[model samples]
Target: MVQTARVLTIGEFSRLTHLSVRTLRRYHEADLLEPAVVDQATGYRYYGVDQIPVAQVIHRLRELDVPLSDVQRILRTPDPGIRAALVAEHLQRLEGVLDRTRAAVVSLRRLLEPDPAPIHVELRSEPARTVAAVEAVVGSGDVEAWFAGAMAELEAAVGDAVTGPPGGTYDNALFEQERGHALVYLPATAPPRVGRVHPVTLPAAELAVTTHVGEHDGVEITYGALGTWVVQNAMSVAGPVREVYLVGPRDAREPAAWRTEIGWPVFRLT
Candidate 1:
């Protein structure tokens, strides 16, 4: 076949593709990409202009840390939608990593504060009541997704019957062992049983309460501070910790305006 597209030597191809000459040789060895033509006498490699786009695509995929096998599959796939879907899956994973990194940065900043603002706490006795709820054994990593789904179901089930702000009790094992029962609900007079939503009786208990402001990512910091205070004081945790959403995403657009009350059931230590 006659060569129609302009051909460039290995050095020129490297410049156009922005790929190192040595890396191009490795791609050839891996069967990822091959030069359009090679000199029989001198063993020199030549690439066609059309291959520049292919090389660029490979470069981009490598930059994203996409596995070599996936990149090869992407390039070989004929369907545009399938190729896009494969890339989207990797992007979703990257987004999860970014979210965790942002949370870590927030935590580190809070921890490194020289003179952090004191966490305010209060002691209160709560009355027992039956509330509309959704309960599940949830993994710590899956809590966010589970909470969103369960809350949607709970809201749909109770609707106008809601009597108080939404709240949840998280058992120690959920955080300590990464999986345990989690109960989320809102106070209601007579909550109907729907799907996973049901009436759960909340037992009355003494609590050490503190409010966590802003987003929930940093709520763990407040938990640490509150736990420290509990140990220093004359109290010990007696049961699952409760969180009452006073002002949240449902009520406001700004995370800065959100308020969550964290209550740890406790009893005075001798």
Candidate 2:
């Protein structure tokens, strides 16, 4: 007679795997892990003792927050290289989520902490300059990607003509309603007409300016501080806000070294 494999009931298998019965049932439903057999008369699930390793692998992957679908794919693939690739891809996604969370925590800490010392606000008159710029009505959700692409285009268009740090003008509606017209520009001796970058003259203005030294995640506080200073000093916001990227990602790889100048066009109320 041939030797027979030991068949364990679902409950026993769950205990051996250290996984709950409910989870085992879910894994079966997801087709991630399946038992070896079922009782024809009782319609009960049973697992071969040989399947213990498979159950443990499924449990470990689930613990790592891998989606059920990916887990299924990982398990179904017999090739070790494919399985490792699937796991590595999910780990990369987790790393991105962690990075965003860490940035958010830094911003939240700045918001919850006691107000810092007053930021120095200065008055300066800017002269009109020719620029290669990209203008669009952009939504808040797409602003970062849009700005990056626009800057890239401006860089490609102007080449050696770019004279100063890149800057942008953001309409109030972009903040108030989450969508509005905006312009990302590079100062140039003469504007280059290429791609979406076009010749435009950025007008001269008197601005109440303040520098934000670090990541832009907490720059809202700088804006609020600057706005308060403008109101307290009897200055009125006269036009769209300007942001000068003095030491941006292109200039410095570290966020700590980035310097952004926020310029609020202002006028003395007559």
Candidate 3:
């Protein structure tokens, strides 16, 4: 009875916008998309035909999982450019989340396989050598960003010419306790000391090394395999873990082509 030539009842608006009546009521309560008319005596709601587009926009924003506050900002913004920028910002966040999700799924699939393939490892004697490096005590969550920044500083200080692949040395606590001292270094003889970048003497050790192919996200599996191998071989860890970048992101565009060598400094157990 409330439906008229100039307005639509709740059911009519729901059909047009493809939103449920309950959802419309909730939106109304939220003051996101209030009905244009409300029957005072019956408490029935009616929306103007002009609100169809706005209702549709709200539905689309919700579909993208846009937060209510952001949706409000996007809907209320007068400038189309600003509106687009807000939506674009949310989309970028979604992409980061999707990338992490895909990486996790890939790792999980490999882990779930019935017959996991064995990894090959080699033993090497690494000598003490001073190299250009940055050292910091960082959290596991901040390691990636810290490494990127440190490497950039290293590149700036050391220049493009390098004798060998750059590497990271992570102490046991960094993995075991999730926060500890970590070092990233690029091989350069007589490398300059500037800012956080300085020369570090890498101590000599026997290392059980294994190369992890593809992206670093799933490289944890390789580490697990290497640990298993070391245990089977009666070798106990003697020092910090070292990750030598054989063919890393700087060397290859495709993650599939990247190779990282993980080394565990070890000692034989009786």
* Alpha-carbon lDDT, every model: 0.92, 0.89, 0.93
* Candidate 3, poorest ten consecutive residues by summed lDDT: 1-10
lDDT value for candidate 3?
0.93
Query: What pairs collide in candidate 1?
Result: none
Judge candidate 2 at residue 85 and give its lDDT. Answer: 94
Q: Which stretches of candidate 1 lie over 4 Å from their true place?
A: 1-5, 25-34, 38-45, 69-89
Evaluation by TM-score, superior candidate among 1 and 2? 1
lDDT of 2 by residue, 44-78 (tens): 78888889998998888888899888888998899
Candidate 3 stretches with Cα past 4 Å from truth are 1-3
Clashing pairs in 3: none
| lDDT by residue for model 1 (98-151), tens | 878887898889999998899999999999989999999999999999999999
RMSD of 1: 3.0
Q: Candidate 2: how many backbone clashes?
A: 0
For 1-270, candidate 3 gives per-residue lDDT tens digits of: 565789988999999999999999999898899999999889999999899999999999999999988999999999999999999999999998897899899999999999999998999999999899999999999999999999999999999656789999999999999999999999986778899998889999899999999999998999999999999999999878999999988888998999999999999998
Ranking by lDDT: 3, 1, 2
Best by lDDT: 3
